[model samples]
Target: MNKEISIQLSNVSKTFRTSSKSFSTLRDRLINFYKKNEVKTIKALKEINLEIHAGETIGVIGRNGSGKSTLTKIMSGTFIPDRGGQVIKNGTSLLLNLGVGFSHELTARENIYVNGSTLGLRISEIDELFYEILEFSELEDFKDTKIKYFSSGMIQRLSFSIAIFAKADIIFLDEVFAVGDNKFRKKATEALKQNWLKNRTSIIVSHSTGVIKEHCDRTILLHKGELIFFGETEKALAMYEELE
Candidate 1:
Protein backbone atom coordinates (compact mmCIF):
# COMPACT_ATOMS: atom_id res chain seq x y z
CA MET A 1 0.00 0.00 0.00
CA ASN A 2 1.19 3.50 -0.81
CA LYS A 3 1.54 6.07 1.93
CA GLU A 4 -0.84 9.02 1.78
CA ILE A 5 0.41 12.58 1.80
CA SER A 6 -0.14 14.24 5.15
CA ILE A 7 1.19 17.73 4.35
CA GLN A 8 2.11 19.55 1.18
CA LEU A 9 3.74 22.97 0.93
CA SER A 10 3.74 24.52 -2.50
CA ASN A 11 5.77 27.66 -3.09
CA VAL A 12 5.28 28.64 0.53
CA SER A 13 6.96 31.75 1.93
CA LYS A 14 6.59 34.00 4.95
CA THR A 15 7.75 37.56 5.56
CA PHE A 16 7.73 39.77 8.62
CA ARG A 17 8.27 43.53 9.01
CA THR A 18 10.02 45.26 11.88
CA SER A 19 10.17 48.96 12.55
CA SER A 20 13.46 50.62 13.41
CA LYS A 21 11.89 53.54 15.25
CA SER A 22 11.14 53.32 18.97
CA PHE A 23 9.04 56.46 19.30
CA SER A 24 7.04 55.99 22.47
CA THR A 25 5.92 59.59 23.00
CA LEU A 26 4.87 62.57 20.88
CA ARG A 27 8.16 64.31 21.69
CA ASP A 28 10.09 61.20 20.62
CA ARG A 29 8.13 61.03 17.39
CA LEU A 30 8.65 64.74 16.69
CA ILE A 31 12.35 64.45 17.37
CA ASN A 32 12.57 61.73 14.71
CA PHE A 33 10.29 63.49 12.23
CA TYR A 34 13.16 64.25 9.92
CA LYS A 35 14.17 60.60 9.94
CA LYS A 36 12.03 58.17 8.09
CA ASN A 37 10.45 55.41 10.11
CA GLU A 38 12.54 52.71 8.53
CA VAL A 39 10.86 49.38 8.26
CA LYS A 40 12.79 46.25 7.42
CA THR A 41 11.17 43.27 5.78
CA ILE A 42 12.54 39.86 6.63
CA LYS A 43 11.85 36.72 4.68
CA ALA A 44 11.34 34.19 7.38
CA LEU A 45 10.72 31.47 4.82
CA LYS A 46 11.65 31.62 1.17
CA GLU A 47 9.67 29.84 -1.53
CA ILE A 48 9.64 26.26 -0.30
CA ASN A 49 8.08 23.11 -1.66
CA LEU A 50 7.78 19.88 0.25
CA GLU A 51 5.56 16.90 0.92
CA ILE A 52 5.30 14.85 4.10
CA HIS A 53 3.90 11.35 4.01
CA ALA A 54 1.73 9.76 6.64
CA GLY A 55 3.63 8.32 9.63
CA GLU A 56 6.89 9.87 8.50
CA THR A 57 9.16 11.43 11.10
CA ILE A 58 11.01 14.47 9.77
CA GLY A 59 13.67 16.45 11.58
CA VAL A 60 14.16 20.13 10.79
CA ILE A 61 17.56 21.58 11.70
CA GLY A 62 18.86 25.08 11.26
CA ARG A 63 20.76 27.87 12.94
CA ASN A 64 18.99 30.61 14.88
CA GLY A 65 16.64 32.62 12.61
CA SER A 66 17.08 30.14 9.80
CA GLY A 67 13.28 29.75 9.50
CA LYS A 68 12.98 26.45 11.33
CA SER A 69 10.31 27.75 13.68
CA THR A 70 8.72 29.75 10.89
CA LEU A 71 8.36 26.65 8.74
CA THR A 72 6.90 24.71 11.66
CA LYS A 73 4.37 27.44 12.33
CA ILE A 74 3.36 27.57 8.71
CA MET A 75 2.89 23.83 8.59
CA SER A 76 0.85 23.92 11.80
CA GLY A 77 -1.38 26.71 10.43
CA THR A 78 -0.39 29.04 13.24
CA PHE A 79 1.29 31.29 10.66
CA ILE A 80 0.13 31.98 7.17
CA PRO A 81 2.43 31.98 4.20
CA ASP A 82 2.69 34.83 1.72
CA ARG A 83 0.25 35.19 -1.17
CA GLY A 84 0.63 32.83 -4.14
CA GLY A 85 1.59 30.08 -1.74
CA GLN A 86 -0.58 27.18 -0.67
CA VAL A 87 -0.41 24.85 2.31
CA ILE A 88 -2.37 21.61 2.05
CA LYS A 89 -3.02 19.73 5.22
CA ASN A 90 -4.75 16.36 4.99
CA GLY A 91 -5.38 15.73 8.68
CA THR A 92 -5.52 17.28 12.13
CA SER A 93 -2.27 18.94 13.22
CA LEU A 94 -0.84 20.29 16.46
CA LEU A 95 2.16 22.48 17.22
CA LEU A 96 3.84 21.95 20.58
CA ASN A 97 5.73 25.05 21.55
CA LEU A 98 6.35 26.01 25.14
CA GLY A 99 3.35 27.69 26.78
CA VAL A 100 1.53 28.18 23.52
CA GLY A 101 -2.30 27.76 23.46
CA PHE A 102 -2.40 27.49 27.22
CA SER A 103 -3.94 29.96 29.67
CA HIS A 104 -1.65 31.05 32.49
CA GLU A 105 -4.45 32.11 34.84
CA LEU A 106 -6.30 28.81 34.57
CA THR A 107 -5.54 25.74 36.62
CA ALA A 108 -3.83 22.75 35.00
CA ARG A 109 -7.14 20.92 34.86
CA GLU A 110 -8.83 23.81 33.08
CA ASN A 111 -5.91 24.32 30.75
CA ILE A 112 -6.13 20.65 29.77
CA TYR A 113 -9.64 21.28 28.50
CA VAL A 114 -8.47 24.40 26.68
CA ASN A 115 -5.57 22.64 25.04
CA GLY A 116 -7.64 19.54 24.26
CA SER A 117 -10.23 21.65 22.51
CA THR A 118 -7.52 23.51 20.68
CA LEU A 119 -6.18 20.17 19.46
CA GLY A 120 -9.66 19.30 18.14
CA LEU A 121 -10.69 16.92 20.87
CA ARG A 122 -14.22 16.86 22.19
CA ILE A 123 -14.88 17.37 25.91
CA SER A 124 -15.96 13.76 26.28
CA GLU A 125 -12.75 12.57 24.64
CA ILE A 126 -10.65 14.74 26.93
CA ASP A 127 -12.55 13.43 29.91
CA GLU A 128 -11.55 9.88 29.05
CA LEU A 129 -7.86 10.84 28.86
CA PHE A 130 -7.78 13.15 31.89
CA TYR A 131 -6.47 10.60 34.35
CA GLU A 132 -3.91 9.32 31.86
CA ILE A 133 -2.64 12.84 31.27
CA LEU A 134 -2.38 13.44 34.99
CA GLU A 135 -0.55 10.19 35.60
CA PHE A 136 1.98 10.80 32.83
CA SER A 137 2.64 14.35 33.99
CA GLU A 138 2.99 13.23 37.61
CA LEU A 139 1.14 16.43 38.52
CA GLU A 140 -2.04 14.92 39.85
CA ASP A 141 -1.67 16.83 43.10
CA PHE A 142 -1.13 20.13 41.30
CA LYS A 143 -4.01 19.79 38.83
CA ASP A 144 -5.97 22.47 40.65
CA THR A 145 -3.02 24.88 40.79
CA LYS A 146 -3.01 27.78 38.36
CA ILE A 147 -0.51 27.48 35.48
CA LYS A 148 1.18 30.74 36.51
CA TYR A 149 2.31 29.14 39.75
CA PHE A 150 3.89 26.13 38.07
CA SER A 151 7.57 26.01 37.27
CA SER A 152 8.74 25.79 33.68
CA GLY A 153 9.59 22.11 34.07
CA MET A 154 6.21 21.38 35.61
CA ILE A 155 4.49 23.24 32.80
CA GLN A 156 6.42 21.30 30.20
CA ARG A 157 5.47 18.02 31.81
CA LEU A 158 1.83 18.96 31.67
CA SER A 159 2.10 20.15 28.08
CA PHE A 160 3.86 17.03 26.93
CA SER A 161 1.38 14.81 28.69
CA ILE A 162 -1.52 16.59 27.07
CA ALA A 163 0.07 16.43 23.62
CA ILE A 164 0.70 12.72 23.83
CA PHE A 165 -3.01 12.28 24.34
CA ALA A 166 -4.04 14.83 21.73
CA LYS A 167 -4.21 12.12 19.01
CA ALA A 168 -3.42 14.58 16.26
CA ASP A 169 -2.71 13.25 12.78
CA ILE A 170 0.41 15.36 12.55
CA ILE A 171 2.49 16.85 15.38
CA PHE A 172 5.12 19.58 15.36
CA LEU A 173 7.71 19.53 18.12
CA ASP A 174 9.82 22.66 18.65
CA GLU A 175 12.65 22.23 21.13
CA VAL A 176 10.40 20.12 23.31
CA PHE A 177 13.27 18.13 24.77
CA ALA A 178 14.97 21.28 26.02
CA VAL A 179 12.46 21.69 28.81
CA GLY A 180 12.15 19.73 32.09
CA ASP A 181 14.77 18.02 34.29
CA ASN A 182 17.02 15.14 33.22
CA LYS A 183 14.80 12.52 34.78
CA PHE A 184 11.70 14.02 33.28
CA ARG A 185 13.47 14.35 29.97
CA LYS A 186 14.23 10.66 30.00
CA LYS A 187 10.64 9.88 30.81
CA ALA A 188 9.41 12.19 28.09
CA THR A 189 11.76 10.68 25.56
CA GLU A 190 10.61 7.19 26.47
CA ALA A 191 6.99 8.21 26.25
CA LEU A 192 7.55 9.85 22.89
CA LYS A 193 9.26 6.82 21.41
CA GLN A 194 6.99 4.23 22.97
CA ASN A 195 3.72 6.04 22.57
CA TRP A 196 3.45 9.50 21.06
CA LEU A 197 5.60 9.07 17.97
CA LYS A 198 4.69 5.52 17.25
CA ASN A 199 3.22 5.45 13.75
CA ARG A 200 2.54 9.17 13.95
CA THR A 201 3.51 11.74 11.35
CA SER A 202 5.72 14.29 13.08
CA ILE A 203 8.02 17.21 12.37
CA ILE A 204 10.69 17.85 14.97
CA VAL A 205 12.90 20.95 15.28
CA SER A 206 15.96 20.63 17.43
CA HIS A 207 19.63 21.68 17.63
CA SER A 208 20.68 18.21 18.73
CA THR A 209 22.03 16.07 15.95
CA GLY A 210 21.67 12.97 18.09
CA VAL A 211 17.95 13.55 18.36
CA ILE A 212 17.56 13.88 14.63
CA LYS A 213 19.63 10.84 13.95
CA GLU A 214 17.74 8.77 16.46
CA HIS A 215 14.16 9.74 15.73
CA CYS A 216 13.97 11.04 12.18
CA ASP A 217 13.85 8.99 9.05
CA ARG A 218 14.76 12.03 6.99
CA THR A 219 16.07 15.53 7.77
CA ILE A 220 15.60 18.98 6.30
CA LEU A 221 18.24 21.69 6.58
CA LEU A 222 17.53 25.38 6.25
CA HIS A 223 19.95 28.26 5.95
CA LYS A 224 18.93 31.91 6.04
CA GLY A 225 15.27 31.06 5.42
CA GLU A 226 16.08 28.91 2.40
CA LEU A 227 15.81 25.19 2.21
CA ILE A 228 19.31 23.82 1.65
CA PHE A 229 18.80 20.10 1.86
CA PHE A 230 16.07 17.51 2.32
CA GLY A 231 17.05 13.89 2.19
CA GLU A 232 18.59 11.09 4.20
CA THR A 233 19.36 11.90 7.82
CA GLU A 234 23.08 11.31 7.46
CA LYS A 235 23.52 13.51 4.42
CA ALA A 236 21.40 16.28 5.90
CA LEU A 237 23.41 16.27 9.11
CA ALA A 238 26.64 16.36 7.18
CA MET A 239 25.40 19.39 5.23
CA TYR A 240 24.29 21.12 8.44
CA GLU A 241 27.65 20.43 10.10
CA GLU A 242 29.55 22.02 7.21
CA LEU A 243 27.90 25.36 8.00
CA GLU A 244 29.24 25.40 11.57
Candidate 2:
Protein backbone atom coordinates (compact mmCIF):
# COMPACT_ATOMS: atom_id res chain seq x y z
CA MET A 1 0.00 0.00 0.00
CA ASN A 2 1.33 3.41 -0.92
CA LYS A 3 1.44 5.85 1.96
CA GLU A 4 0.13 8.67 -0.22
CA ILE A 5 -2.96 6.73 -1.15
CA SER A 6 -5.71 7.64 1.24
CA ILE A 7 -8.23 5.07 0.07
CA GLN A 8 -7.93 1.79 -1.87
CA LEU A 9 -10.46 -0.79 -2.87
CA SER A 10 -9.51 -4.08 -4.51
CA ASN A 11 -12.00 -6.43 -6.09
CA VAL A 12 -14.64 -5.03 -3.81
CA SER A 13 -18.23 -6.14 -3.96
CA LYS A 14 -21.36 -6.00 -1.83
CA THR A 15 -24.51 -8.13 -1.78
CA PHE A 16 -27.62 -8.12 0.37
CA ARG A 17 -29.81 -11.10 1.00
CA THR A 18 -33.51 -10.97 1.66
CA SER A 19 -36.26 -13.53 1.93
CA SER A 20 -40.00 -13.38 1.20
CA LYS A 21 -42.93 -15.75 1.53
CA SER A 22 -46.57 -15.51 0.59
CA PHE A 23 -49.26 -16.49 3.06
CA SER A 24 -52.58 -14.78 2.61
CA THR A 25 -54.36 -16.84 5.24
CA LEU A 26 -53.71 -18.98 8.28
CA ARG A 27 -54.25 -22.16 6.23
CA ASP A 28 -51.81 -20.88 3.62
CA ARG A 29 -49.32 -19.95 6.30
CA LEU A 30 -49.57 -23.39 7.79
CA ILE A 31 -49.11 -25.01 4.40
CA ASN A 32 -46.19 -22.75 3.54
CA PHE A 33 -44.53 -23.26 6.91
CA TYR A 34 -43.00 -26.50 5.66
CA LYS A 35 -41.65 -24.85 2.50
CA LYS A 36 -38.49 -22.82 2.22
CA ASN A 37 -38.80 -19.10 1.92
CA GLU A 38 -37.85 -17.55 -1.40
CA VAL A 39 -34.51 -15.81 -1.06
CA LYS A 40 -33.03 -13.17 -3.27
CA THR A 41 -29.60 -11.57 -3.45
CA ILE A 42 -29.06 -8.01 -4.50
CA LYS A 43 -25.59 -7.24 -5.77
CA ALA A 44 -25.09 -3.60 -4.96
CA LEU A 45 -21.47 -3.41 -6.08
CA LYS A 46 -19.11 -5.70 -7.96
CA GLU A 47 -15.40 -5.94 -8.62
CA ILE A 48 -14.62 -2.37 -7.74
CA ASN A 49 -10.98 -1.37 -7.90
CA LEU A 50 -9.91 2.12 -6.94
CA GLU A 51 -7.02 4.07 -5.50
CA ILE A 52 -7.48 7.63 -4.26
CA HIS A 53 -4.48 9.75 -3.46
CA ALA A 54 -4.38 12.12 -0.54
CA GLY A 55 -5.78 15.63 -1.11
CA GLU A 56 -7.60 14.51 -4.24
CA THR A 57 -11.19 15.55 -4.91
CA ILE A 58 -13.07 12.84 -6.79
CA GLY A 59 -16.64 12.85 -8.01
CA VAL A 60 -18.92 9.81 -8.25
CA ILE A 61 -21.87 9.92 -10.63
CA GLY A 62 -24.54 7.36 -11.39
CA ARG A 63 -28.24 6.98 -11.78
CA ASN A 64 -30.53 5.46 -9.21
CA GLY A 65 -29.41 2.00 -7.99
CA SER A 66 -26.14 2.37 -9.84
CA GLY A 67 -24.22 1.72 -6.60
CA LYS A 68 -22.89 5.23 -6.03
CA SER A 69 -24.05 5.36 -2.43
CA THR A 70 -22.96 1.78 -1.85
CA LEU A 71 -19.45 2.55 -3.02
CA THR A 72 -19.36 5.63 -0.80
CA LYS A 73 -20.46 3.58 2.19
CA ILE A 74 -17.79 0.99 1.44
CA MET A 75 -15.15 3.67 1.32
CA SER A 76 -16.44 5.30 4.48
CA GLY A 77 -16.26 2.01 6.42
CA THR A 78 -19.99 1.99 7.03
CA PHE A 79 -20.53 -1.05 4.81
CA ILE A 80 -18.20 -4.01 4.55
CA PRO A 81 -17.46 -5.40 1.14
CA ASP A 82 -18.05 -9.02 0.31
CA ARG A 83 -15.49 -11.77 0.83
CA GLY A 84 -12.40 -11.95 -1.38
CA GLY A 85 -12.32 -8.15 -1.41
CA GLN A 86 -10.21 -5.67 0.53
CA VAL A 87 -10.51 -2.06 1.58
CA ILE A 88 -7.51 -0.12 2.82
CA LYS A 89 -7.93 3.26 4.47
CA ASN A 90 -4.80 5.12 5.43
CA GLY A 91 -6.31 7.87 7.58
CA THR A 92 -9.42 9.09 9.32
CA SER A 93 -12.55 9.29 7.16
CA LEU A 94 -16.02 10.73 7.51
CA LEU A 95 -19.20 10.19 5.49
CA LEU A 96 -21.64 13.11 5.24
CA ASN A 97 -25.06 11.83 4.23
CA LEU A 98 -28.52 13.11 5.05
CA GLY A 99 -29.42 12.44 8.69
CA VAL A 100 -26.55 10.05 9.20
CA GLY A 101 -24.73 9.86 12.55
CA PHE A 102 -27.20 12.24 14.17
CA SER A 103 -29.66 11.79 16.99
CA HIS A 104 -32.93 13.48 16.16
CA GLU A 105 -33.94 13.57 19.80
CA LEU A 106 -30.89 15.54 20.76
CA THR A 107 -30.78 19.30 20.45
CA ALA A 108 -28.70 20.78 17.65
CA ARG A 109 -26.16 21.93 20.19
CA GLU A 110 -25.88 18.48 21.73
CA ASN A 111 -25.67 16.79 18.34
CA ILE A 112 -22.59 18.83 17.59
CA TYR A 113 -20.82 17.28 20.54
CA VAL A 114 -22.11 13.81 19.75
CA ASN A 115 -21.41 13.93 16.05
CA GLY A 116 -18.03 15.54 16.59
CA SER A 117 -17.07 12.74 18.92
CA THR A 118 -18.19 10.18 16.38
CA LEU A 119 -15.99 11.85 13.82
CA GLY A 120 -13.02 11.38 16.19
CA LEU A 121 -12.93 14.89 17.60
CA ARG A 122 -12.08 15.38 21.24
CA ILE A 123 -14.20 17.40 23.60
CA SER A 124 -11.76 20.29 23.64
CA GLU A 125 -11.55 20.41 19.87
CA ILE A 126 -15.33 20.48 19.50
CA ASP A 127 -15.52 23.14 22.20
CA GLU A 128 -13.10 25.35 20.31
CA LEU A 129 -15.04 24.99 17.05
CA PHE A 130 -18.54 25.01 18.57
CA TYR A 131 -19.34 28.63 17.79
CA GLU A 132 -17.87 28.30 14.31
CA ILE A 133 -20.14 25.35 13.62
CA LEU A 134 -23.14 27.31 14.81
CA GLU A 135 -22.27 30.27 12.61
CA PHE A 136 -21.68 28.11 9.55
CA SER A 137 -24.94 26.30 10.07
CA GLU A 138 -26.77 29.61 10.42
CA LEU A 139 -28.76 28.09 13.19
CA GLU A 140 -27.42 29.95 16.16
CA ASP A 141 -30.91 30.78 17.30
CA PHE A 142 -31.98 27.16 17.04
CA LYS A 143 -28.99 25.60 18.77
CA ASP A 144 -30.97 24.45 21.73
CA THR A 145 -33.85 23.15 19.64
CA LYS A 146 -34.13 19.42 19.01
CA ILE A 147 -33.02 18.18 15.62
CA LYS A 148 -36.38 16.46 15.17
CA TYR A 149 -37.96 19.89 14.97
CA PHE A 150 -35.58 21.10 12.28
CA SER A 151 -36.31 20.96 8.58
CA SER A 152 -34.29 18.66 6.35
CA GLY A 153 -32.29 21.60 5.10
CA MET A 154 -31.43 22.68 8.61
CA ILE A 155 -30.21 19.22 9.52
CA GLN A 156 -28.05 19.05 6.41
CA ARG A 157 -26.55 22.42 7.15
CA LEU A 158 -25.62 21.29 10.63
CA SER A 159 -24.17 18.03 9.34
CA PHE A 160 -22.01 19.72 6.71
CA SER A 161 -20.85 22.30 9.23
CA ILE A 162 -19.69 19.60 11.62
CA ALA A 163 -18.06 17.58 8.81
CA ILE A 164 -16.00 20.50 7.59
CA PHE A 165 -14.68 21.04 11.08
CA ALA A 166 -14.18 17.39 11.89
CA LYS A 167 -10.72 17.56 10.25
CA ALA A 168 -10.88 14.09 8.81
CA ASP A 169 -8.31 13.10 6.21
CA ILE A 170 -10.88 11.51 3.88
CA ILE A 171 -14.41 12.84 3.36
CA PHE A 172 -17.31 11.30 1.47
CA LEU A 173 -20.32 13.46 0.58
CA ASP A 174 -23.56 12.01 -0.78
CA GLU A 175 -25.84 14.54 -2.50
CA VAL A 176 -24.65 17.29 -0.19
CA PHE A 177 -25.33 20.12 -2.63
CA ALA A 178 -29.02 19.25 -2.63
CA VAL A 179 -29.25 20.50 0.92
CA GLY A 180 -30.30 23.94 2.19
CA ASP A 181 -31.45 26.95 0.26
CA ASN A 182 -29.38 28.59 -2.44
CA LYS A 183 -27.50 30.96 -0.15
CA PHE A 184 -26.57 28.31 2.38
CA ARG A 185 -25.71 25.78 -0.30
CA LYS A 186 -23.39 28.26 -1.90
CA LYS A 187 -21.80 28.97 1.46
CA ALA A 188 -21.27 25.26 2.10
CA THR A 189 -19.85 24.71 -1.39
CA GLU A 190 -17.38 27.54 -0.96
CA ALA A 191 -16.33 26.26 2.42
CA LEU A 192 -15.58 22.88 0.89
CA LYS A 193 -13.67 24.26 -2.09
CA GLN A 194 -11.62 26.76 -0.11
CA ASN A 195 -10.95 24.85 3.07
CA TRP A 196 -11.94 21.19 3.28
CA LEU A 197 -11.61 19.75 -0.26
CA LYS A 198 -8.40 21.65 -0.94
CA ASN A 199 -6.43 19.64 1.60
CA ARG A 200 -8.35 16.40 2.19
CA THR A 201 -9.17 13.36 0.13
CA SER A 202 -12.80 13.78 -0.90
CA ILE A 203 -15.29 11.59 -2.74
CA ILE A 204 -18.44 13.49 -3.68
CA VAL A 205 -21.52 11.68 -5.00
CA SER A 206 -23.84 14.05 -6.82
CA HIS A 207 -26.17 14.20 -9.80
CA SER A 208 -25.05 17.69 -10.84
CA THR A 209 -22.69 17.76 -13.76
CA GLY A 210 -21.71 21.34 -13.01
CA VAL A 211 -20.49 20.45 -9.54
CA ILE A 212 -18.33 17.59 -10.78
CA LYS A 213 -16.75 19.72 -13.47
CA GLU A 214 -16.16 22.61 -11.12
CA HIS A 215 -14.67 20.92 -8.06
CA CYS A 216 -13.50 17.43 -8.83
CA ASP A 217 -10.06 16.60 -10.13
CA ARG A 218 -11.24 13.21 -11.35
CA THR A 219 -14.53 11.36 -11.69
CA ILE A 220 -15.78 7.81 -11.37
CA LEU A 221 -18.87 6.53 -13.10
CA LEU A 222 -20.82 3.49 -12.00
CA HIS A 223 -23.57 1.55 -13.74
CA LYS A 224 -25.48 -1.49 -12.64
CA GLY A 225 -23.10 -2.02 -9.70
CA GLU A 226 -20.04 -1.95 -11.92
CA LEU A 227 -17.26 0.53 -12.39
CA ILE A 228 -17.87 1.95 -15.84
CA PHE A 229 -15.26 4.68 -15.96
CA PHE A 230 -12.62 6.36 -13.82
CA GLY A 231 -10.67 9.18 -15.35
CA GLU A 232 -10.78 12.87 -16.19
CA THR A 233 -13.95 14.65 -15.09
CA GLU A 234 -15.08 15.68 -18.56
CA LYS A 235 -14.71 12.23 -20.06
CA ALA A 236 -16.49 10.57 -17.16
CA LEU A 237 -19.35 13.03 -17.48
CA ALA A 238 -19.60 12.25 -21.15
CA MET A 239 -19.74 8.55 -20.46
CA TYR A 240 -22.36 9.11 -17.79
CA GLU A 241 -24.55 11.06 -20.18
CA GLU A 242 -24.23 8.32 -22.77
CA LEU A 243 -25.47 5.81 -20.23
CA GLU A 244 -28.59 7.89 -19.81
Query: Tens digits of per-residue lDDT for model 2 on 1-244?
Result: 2339889999999998776646556777788998776778999998999999988899999999999999999998989999999999998888888677899999999999999998889999999999999999999999999999998888988998998877688889899888789988888888888777887889999999998998899999999999999999999999999988
Candidate 1, residues 49-135: lDDT per residue as tens digits? 998889899999999999999999999998999999999999888899866777899999999999988888899999999999999
TM-score of each: 0.90, 0.92
TM-score for candidate 1, residues paired by index: 0.90
Error of 2 at 63 (Å): 0.9
Model 1 residue 39 CA deviation (Å) reads: 2.4
Candidate 2 local distance difference test against the native? 0.90
